[model samples]
Target: MVRTPLTPEERRRGERLGALLREARGGRSMIEIAASAGISAETLRKIETGRAPTPAFFTVAALAGALGLSMDEILTRCAPEPDAVPLAG
Candidate 1:
């Protein structure tokens, strides 16, 4: 199946998600966190570095669970500002 390309805004949001995850990780080792999340360290690294932005939903759920982040928090932290104008169709 073909995948749609991410928009600039989506890319920015992904970067923000990466940053948030990194900050939440604190001093924990990547391997430890990755294991707890049931994912490989390389996959976590890719997400943290924004190299694999838009990971699968379950992967994100696992990461969020391991990191003690709520879905609401993720949405609040990663979403664009409320006042930002929407892109023209």
Candidate 2:
């Protein structure tokens, strides 16, 4: 199936998610975190680097569990700024 291209906002949101994950992963090795999350280090690295921004739901859940982050917090943190106006398509 062909995937639709991501909008710039989506890219920025992904970057924000990556940053949050990296911050939550402090003091832990990527291998350790990945193993705990039941994912490969490379996959974790990709997510953390925004190379694989749009990860699957389960993958995100696992990562959140591993990092002790709540989905609600993730949603809140990754949301676009309240004052930022959306561009007309």
Candidate 3:
């Protein structure tokens, strides 16, 4: 199946999510965190680097649980910038 290209906004949101996860990781090793989240180190690395911008919901939940982050926090932090104008169709 073909995948749709991510929009600029989606890219930005992914970057934000990546940064947030990276920060939350603190000094923890990527491998350690990935294991705790029941994912591969490479998968965590991709998400952290914004290479895998849109991960599966379960993957995100697992990561959040491992990082002690609430989904609400993620949603809030990843929200569009206040100054960003809505995209017109």
Candidate 4:
């Protein structure tokens, strides 16, 4: 099956995630963070620069873990709306 490209919103999400990681990684070198995240320095650089927007889920998860960012925080930060009502239970 053919694969569709990521939407603009998804790309923005990736950029937001990258910014968060950079903030969390303050005072740390890219190599150190990449090593801790189990990814190559170039991969981390791409992600951090939004060059690899919409990176694989596993990659995001690993980076989040290494950067010490909680899922809730990432979601809240990357989400477009902060006050959108949730669906009724």
Identify the candidate with maximal lDDT.
Answer: 3
Tens digit per residue, CA lDDT, model 4, 16-74: 87898889899999999999989999999998898887778788778888889887887
Give the whole-model CA lDDT for all candidates, comma-separated. Answer: 0.90, 0.92, 0.94, 0.84
User: Which regions of candidate 4 deviate over 4 angstroms?
Assistant: 1-3, 81-89
Q: Estimated TM-score per prediction?
A: 0.86, 0.89, 0.90, 0.78
> Residues 24-75, candidate 3, lDDT per residue (tens digit)?
9999999999999999999999998999988898999999999999999999
lDDT of 4: 0.84
Tens digits of per-residue lDDT, candidate 2, 19-62, equal 99999999999999999999999999998899988888899899
Error of 4 at 14 (Å): 1.5
**lDDT at position 8, candidate 1:** 78
Off by over 4 Å in 1: 83-89
Ranking by lDDT: 3, 2, 1, 4
| lDDT, residue 38, model 1 | 100
Work out candidate 1's RMSD over C-alphas: 4.1
Residue 84 alpha-carbon offset, candidate 4, angstroms: 10
lDDT of 1 by residue, 12-88 (tens): 78898899999999999999999999999999999999888888889988999999999889889999756668799
If ranked by TM-score, best first, what sequence of candidates would result?
3, 2, 1, 4
Worst 10 residues of 3 by lDDT: 77-86
Spell out the clash pairs found in candidate 3.
none
| Model 4 Cα shift for residue 71 (angstroms) | 1.7
Query: How displaced is residue 49 in candidate 3, in Å?
Result: 0.5
Model 3 score (lDDT): 0.94
Error of 3 at 19 (Å): 0.3
